[model samples]
Target: MLQPVPFPIRKECPPGACICERERLLDDPQGDTRILRLTSEEEKRLVARIDSISTYADLQHIEERMREQLGIDLRISPGMHEVRTVRGFNIQIVERPGLCRKTRQSIPAAIRRCLDKNPDIAYAILNAHDLLRDD
Candidate 1:
């Protein structure tokens, strides 16, 4: 049986960037090298792929579910959180989503309010992508 030989391919890069092609010698275990920049959607797809519980084909399924339920994405760190001291005597309210001077409002306040109200919330993040799709 005969097999056809493969050929090499070339690509161009944008200005101010260098794209070098390197080929390692035989016996070297190192594989090919490459750099890739993934978009947020790409990251979500990867996450969904890695998720064992969700048999989702893409991030959209999980994202839509999360956004519909949480009104935020998995990356959305709440504006605030409440913690009870180990002694169980003191309850602390922490607001780190500092104030937005532009609107003279604090992001933490909104986050905190949401967290304080939802005691059963296991995880709350702003799923903006999924929320937007709903509209």
Candidate 2:
């Protein structure tokens, strides 16, 4: 008899929009994608970095560093939000269900380690939303 593989329990979120466990919509043969939510301090730092971008070169530098270090794709586009003029964006660190539960759970810690080692990647994610807003 073959033993059944155990899967990680999906985190439950309350009704309404919650960033705690956002699901990524894409072609994932593996399964649903999990997003890495930032902590309050991290969010503050990211907002500050986003506010500091004064030139296209600065944004480009952040993007390059993130790709090189985190191996994650950055995407920015015009989107509708609560405010008519505001744009929505997403910087996703995807972990598929096919991956070992341990590996999947370690994603956040791994990202934090990378951020601590080189913070520019976090800046890239924060600044991504600003790209469409500035234009």
Among all candidates shown, the one with the greatest lDDT? 2
Q: Which stretches of candidate 1 lie over 4 Å from their true place?
A: 1-82, 85-99, 102-105, 122-135
- lDDT of model 1 at residue 41? 47
Q: Relative to the true structure, how large is the alpha-carbon lDDT of every model?
A: 0.28, 0.40
Q: How close is candidate 1 to the true structure, as a TM-score?
A: 0.19
Clash pairs, model 1 backbone: 72-125, 72-126, 72-127, 73-125, 73-126, 73-127, 79-111
Clashes of each: 7, 0
lDDT of 1 by residue, 1-135 (tens): 212213322222334343222122111334221111222344344334433232213334544553453222333332343334112112122211111121112222333343344433212122332321334
TM-scores for the candidates: 0.19, 0.32
lDDT of 1 at 74: 34
In order, what is each prediction's RMSD in angstroms?
17.0, 11.2
In model 1, the Cα lDDT at residue 112 comes to: 37
User: RMSD in Å for candidate 2, one decimal?
Assistant: 11.2
